[model samples]
Target: MIADQPQQTRDPQAPKGRPTPKRSEAQSQRRSLANSSSKMSRKDATRRQREARRADMARQREALAGGDERYLPARDKGPVRRFARDYVDSRFFVAEFFLPLAVVILVLSMIQAGAMQTYVLLLWMLVILLIVINSVVLGIKLKRQLRKRFPDENLRGVVAYALMRTLQMRRLRLPKPQVKRGERP
Candidate 1:
């Protein structure tokens, strides 16, 4: 009876607790997991980067429109610059008319008459002189005002900045005028 009992067999390559997986099967599982994780992370990073860029652009536009100070560009930031901008915005300057006057003079000079040509030249010279005088007066006044308002602040480029701003048409001014014309700086 003992000799008639059936015998049991086990696979030599398999472990005691589980069957051994094929090398190809193991590699495929790892590759699938890594691909899924990397794709998700890469997509998330791209979305976050896009959001940050959009927020930055919105802030810049707001600053350009004079709506917020936090996003103002480096050149336009600071109290002194703000004051100068306000000062220039609050008044009308004769220099603002220079472009239109020059255009008119150019058209007049194009006429065939000699006398008209001479008159246009003289008019152009006169307009230039007036603009120069106006700029000088504005520079002096702006310097005094800036000194009084920001005594501790550096006045180095404030005058020049203000003068350049004055030369621009009011509507075209960047960091568009926060204060209305005739308003106190």
Candidate 2:
């Protein structure tokens, strides 16, 4: 009789005895929020690792030095500072402004003469002399103006130094090999 009796199955409509594990959106939000901070993000973790490595290296350096600190040598001041001078020598303000104008005038005078005149050499020489003399005077005036503005500053030298530096650049002392020239480790 027992062998012939069929086993009874659990009712399909009955609820499960165990508690369900489903989480609500609010619960998931809370869990993710907590995890976002608790779990070190890749970026933060990498930064922390780098910082630790740097500290370790610094400590190792100090230990190797046996407490003796090494100081780096002072770098050279620029050429501009080394060669600074007073600028704006005021001796030739009129000449500075008039040199160009004088050339223009000389050309016009030559044109007016309409022939190879007797004064050509004189006019040409006059322009050249004016240019040279006025240039010197201009340098002086520039120096004077610089003195007035800066007072304590060496204006003419500064101006000259600045001009020279602007026109030229310091040469590089060494050539760096290109990365592609050797195998990158």
Candidate 3:
């Protein structure tokens, strides 16, 4: 069979008649290629790492502002959380004004006069009552909607998540509100 076959021609680009490299030599070359980053200087590596981190942070910030699910933090991920966020955002909540109301109450409390003290106390009580009433109403309604929209979801922390989002000033809420006030989520 060998004698009957014509001679094969090698390409001009072929190695100059050198024998194949040993298995160890081939493996070492592959390892070096795979880890070529080992040759990078420490400063260069750090700079590259810093740039990558900054880019990631920027993407996360954009996602938070624009409600992009893919880059959101784990706590903010998932359709259930998105729905909860939207449900909280779509309505006006008294809890959203808690900070300003608290500040006003704080300033009022500083007035030491008897009538002002009485007024401040009343205002504080009223604000707290309103917040509690509002939160309860919101929770009840949200629970109903959640049940209707997502019956199979694990709803353990979802209500709390929506309530907490309500507590934040609307302007400061992370994964910023996609639904406008009074809009259906």
Candidate 4:
């Protein structure tokens, strides 16, 4: 006699196990999911994105001009850097005039008149000497000030940072100078 076989039946309310879906159905599901995430129209989304970018740029510009630390670049962040910037800005340096002096020297060198080249050479040497001397003085002063004010702060690259800042024209420096000339940082 044949043995009576027991048939397995899935419960109607149970989830379907590992069924393969058709391509069209899968595509439809993906479309629905993508649509659900962002309900706004494309134009509206783009407008919002543009506005966000504009707002961010405005904040950064303001930070650069006003010396706001939070929005400043990584290199310019922290009290150590702020102090360095202020220190550089408070005093005049020969390095700041290097660009203008170089332009003047260039024009003078272009003149072929007798002794013009000689004077231009002398001016160049003088300007370079003054800049080197100024940089040395600025470095020494900045190091002393940094040591005094930021005793516990890491001071790596700070002297270089201030020296580089000194090279840039004051009006063009990023995180524009907050302290007036001759003011103590």
Name the candidate, 1 or 4, with the larger TM-score value. Answer: 4
What's the TM-score of each model vs. the native? 0.70, 0.25, 0.74, 0.74
Candidate 3: tens digits of C-alpha lDDT, residues 1-185: 58989887665665676667889999999999868866557678899999999999999999999989999988899988999998898888888999999998999899889899999998989988998999899889989988999999888888899889989999999998898999987
Best by lDDT: 4
Rate residue 23 of model 2 by lDDT. 73
User: Against the unseen true structure, what C-alpha lDDT does each candidate score?
Assistant: 0.87, 0.44, 0.89, 0.90
User: How far does residue 90 in candidate 4 sit from its true spot (Å)?
Assistant: 1.3
Candidate 4: 10-residue stretch with minimal lDDT? 10-19
Error of 2 at 7 (Å): 89
Q: Flag the better candidate by TM-score, 1 or 3.
A: 3
* Comparing 1 and 2 on TM-score, the stronger one: 1
Give the per-residue lDDT of model 2 (tens digit) for 5-124: 898765665557444455796689888888788555866998999999888767655533332223211121232232221121211123334445566666766665646455666666
For every candidate in turn, the CA RMSD to the true structure comes to 13.0, 23.6, 10.6, 6.3
Where does the lowest 10-residue lDDT sum fall in candidate 2? 172-181
Relative to the true structure, candidate 3 reaches a TM of 0.74
Off by over 4 Å in 2: 1-117, 154-185
- Compared with the true structure, model 2 gives a TM-score of 0.25
**Candidate 4 lDDT by residue in tens digits, 83-147:** 99999999889999889888988988999988988988999999999999999998898899899
Rank by lDDT (best first): 4, 3, 1, 2
